[model samples]
Target: MDYGIMFQEENESMKERFDLSMERIGQIISEETVPQPFRDYFVRTASFIRMMGEYLRFIESGDQKKASIEVLKEWNRKLYEDILPGHKAALGGYEKSYADPAYAAARLGEGYGRLFSYLYKEIRGDIVFVHENRMKDITILNETFIEIYNMFEDEIPEVSTVKEVLYWFVSDYTDHTVSYRVREGLDPSLSFAVDIIKNYDLNDLKYLYYFGEYISDSELKTASFLNSLPEETVRLMANTYTEGYCRGFEVMGRDLKKKGMVQIRYELGFERMVKYAIENFEALGLKIILCRAAVWTVNTNAGRKAGYYSTSPNRQYEYDHRYDEAIYLNKAFKDRKAAVLKVAYEEYKELAAAYAGPAVMETFGKEGFKPVNKPEANRLDLKQEKLAVEMSNESSRILKQYVPGDETSFTIIAFPVPEIGEDFEKIFEETIAINTLDYEKYKGIQQSIIDALDEASHVEIRGKGENRTRLTVALHPIGNRDRETNFENCVADVNIPLGEVFTSPRLTGTQGTLSVSTVYIGEFQFKNLIMTFENGMIKDYGCDNFENPEEGKALVKQMILKNHDTLPMGEFAIGTNTTAYAMAQRFGILDKLPILIVEKMGPHFAVGDTCYSWAEDSPVYNPDGKEIIARDNEVSVLRKEDVSKAYFSCHTDITIPYAELDSIETIRPDGSRVSIIEDGKFVLKGTEELNLPLSGV
Candidate 1:
């Protein structure tokens, strides 16, 4: 399908108006009216924007489709060849760069900033119009487009005096552009982006390339397949998706009505379902923000990115270059980002106020990611890591200062990708079934286990065979049964196809060796993973996948452990979703599953930030209406006094499947043993139904 024709029959007509923005800016830069230094900057900026525009127009025309390998090369080039020049200039504090003090002051002081601002706004407006209101001729989106376009329609702003305009550009755009940095920092929920896939016409492949984002066959193919699914099936998929989002708000006890919107972040191909989710959210009176991930630095986060996006054309390439920040690190770069974000948020305060948060539709089931580590690629050295952490913390604090942490909520759900293996479709169908599992059945069984756990002072979890996991997680005793419960009875909401009773374990005596035969953490592969915990924090870790010892250590350091010297074992729990495990084994896609889904497949361990990071004070309860008292470990408790020591800003799960386990036992206060899984199978009496999937074996 000509995706544009799906919504935009007049994409050609849009050409003239759209090209004019860049053309007019080019005209201004070419004009002799602008001063030499100011003119030089716009000359470079204008050329870059126009090059991007031309490239976008080419992709939009749906001609000269490049092969995946070719696209991947360009993708590599853009991140390396094309964009790095500008990033380096800006980071090095060069006067010629846009972030230069003299240039910013001049650009903002002169009317040039606002004109360029207006020009940039026009391009942004076009992108937004294409996304939000895709109707006849883009008539609705172009209404604002017409108003903004007419600025150049009247007296063209002078090129010579553009400094002052640039300041307002930064000032006006700050609030809207950077609001999520806070949302991410504070709550970090998946609801931050759910509608991207729910409402759009993913079948309209033209929409794929319109955002000026680089795209490859992988992304287009993914979206096309999803669009091919029956509309009803897609709706069921979306309903399962958005329902998890709403349930998050309901479970959190936050007032969803106060919030007016939900940000939908997703990959390509899921637009058919995205549209349905938008309607579902709208039915609840929440508007949807369908923002794509950042292509420009003003909104980029190097590796840890959010917003609607496409698949990484190459994960190895991405892994190699994740720490691109080292190219331009200093107090100056931080200040520039901070100034820009602050300004952007100020501009969008009203919209930010209306945001409920993100509802993410995540996908998994791709082959296990075994990223080849590249040492030459820029990485945050020890000093840079500290600075990066500090910058993140400060920026987060800046965001929360505007958007309160107490106000929003979110949810995340992952599905399988077609690239998982030979039985991709079969696994995908099974995953859907898992996502829509019987809530009441699991809830009842989970409560029975929680009831048992409430009586225990601590849970002793040990592994067998190649698995060396031995951790004693102390449980917070439930003081009152009538008002509170020990573990939250996880169902098919928020975390779908769920079967785990998890909490922030008391860290005082939570120590021992935790190991998994193999696990995928953060899209990077791990094998024969071992971690030793001392008072909950990860004291030591090792993996045997890479050849050299130091290389393996660095791999774990950068990916799994998030560069922290040590991370607290943030979460420890049993896996109640034996059906998920059975399905994985049956389909032979165990290694391909995402942690979001894999964690549900077995007993897992999380290293870094606890599940209750920002909202420990907000009381949570199990299905039996009992308050879950185990929301904090000793590390999180520091938040009540010192904020610096409170968070490690990461939580990655390493799951041990039932097949790898010796046992998962619950220890009663009197030291009695209650086995949940023994010899790689469910042995708990009430949990026998979970073992039904493994019947033949």
Candidate 2:
């Protein structure tokens, strides 16, 4: 009856029994742990099983409900604070460990890895075998165990049972597990930091131990840096993020008061800022949801993006496993995940719809992650790619079914962490100042440029210096000056630290070459990256990130284009964040700036869905009521005929730095071209203020 607290009830005796079992497992590992290289693995596997029990306790012991937050924090501290650092160190040794196939087999053979992996995958997969009970879903959890148990016994089961278990797991839990595993998806009260910060002293290093996230110099340095900055700086950072979130509701014309939760996704270093944002959201009647980076299955590393997470221990390992699902993914799994997602959404429909959206803080600049190309590390086969595309499209549809596009609005803001370089602090301050720039003045000035661009049928942009990029983007027609505008007058709120004028370019006439010298899209870097566009879709692409040209193309497909054969040029924008660009140049860390900041450094284009891909029907006003008619182009409007084909689910901004640009000219229907920026400086009369930083620096 109390199955909800099944693992929670592990008493001292039960824990002792687990310990003994682990000891025996460990002894077996030390003896038979073949290859000998995996000695350390068998060692850690034992610890993992033991530690998970601690987590199991706080999760189920409704008794610790009062101190549960602190308990959970302590449990996490054990994971991140205590274990992760050493785990990172041990990983270096693992390369040598795995070299010995015998040891690798022995270590993996310990069966404990399979056990926890099974438990994690199964329980999280949303098995509600005990569905009539109020505690939690047990049916779904046991199916995973049964699979692992079957595997553990080395006994093959009937094909139908395996299929049934997987179907229910994927179909019932993709959204639920995805939303649960990461805060951005749903489950608001899970902010890992909120519990830690509330229960421990911010000034105490001991406090870091409770979070269960990896603790390292980077995390500690980040926390120390923000704590040392004037409280005003921290408040400014929080205000920029929170105000933008509130403004998202305001801009979308959605009622903020009705939304009960706000999802906060960030790397571990910014807990101080997150702490403030959590409080700020609370004041707005919104609760905080904080989930971890995907670990179990179903939703692990997809690409450059990870939801709420700490710095990665090994980015290359992640890169290798990004497509690990290819091993078992099939039509049945896809249908199952979709089905689980539907069932889970129905089960948590109220929570799903109530989720306001995510307030994201993305980080950049960690030794410019150059991933090694691993050929043997499983990849998604061609068949899997099609199925994956269909699955994701269907998953998105099913998710939207519960949390309709019209009801939710989200915002993203990014900042660089200390890992950027020696000048991390200076870069951070400059970034902060740039985020809080005077939006009122820019708004008026942006309106003038927007008015001029509104009259253009097409815009021509040419690259200067070594930059070979030359492109043309077509604009939508506006019969009335009062009703439509070519570009959205982006100010500070919603997209905090704002600095861009963006529009959904007309796909029919938009054609030319869009290229950048070097840019970071998610995790991978593109060198001498070039994409040719005809009728707005990427016609051809090539980059020089890897020595092998085929590898280079594959990297682009995997990281940038996301395996899609082609993507339409969804957005064209002019970034007015010159001040921020100046700071980056001043600090000599231009490559270190995150896209959130870099996208505002120059005119950038996004090749995928437009900014309002899903919420196009939701009216969006840019302070002034001029309806933004540039919401849909040829590609996205395909939703009317086939929803799956309409959205590409990717929006990557590639910026051409101000110094690299030759000029931007708005071409009118009368054959006259008017210059908005000439020779890398704002020439539009009203936008001269944008050049202040240029002269000052």
Question: Which candidate number has the best lDDT?
Answer: 2
Q: What are the models' TM-scores?
A: 0.75, 0.84
Per-residue alpha-carbon lDDT of candidate 2 for residues 550-660, written as tens digits (9 for 90 to 100): 888888877778778899998999999888888878877777666778888889999888988887777677777888888998989988898888997778889998888
Once fitted onto the true fold, the runs of candidate 2 whose alpha carbons sit more than 4 angstroms away are 1-27, 30-94, 97-184, 304-306
What would the TM-score be for candidate 2 when compared with the true structure?
A: 0.84
In model 1, which runs have C-alpha deviations exceeding 4 angstroms?
1-53, 56-204, 297-299, 335-347
- Whole-model lDDT values for every prediction: 0.63, 0.69
lDDT of 1 by residue, 1-697 (tens): 2233433445455556655555665565456554554455456555555554544444445442443445534533442232232443234322333322234335544334324333332333233333332222223223333333334435454553233333344344444435544433223122323322433345556555544344655566667777777888888988988888878778778788898777777776666667788789889987666656653333555446677766664455455446544544556656666776676567667766777777887787666666565433445778877777667766666566566656777777777666765676677677788888888898888777777777777777767777777778877777776676656777776677678878777777788888887787756668888888887877888888778777778778777776778888778766688778888787777777777778877777788777777777888766667788877888888988988788877788888887777776788778897877778777777877877877754
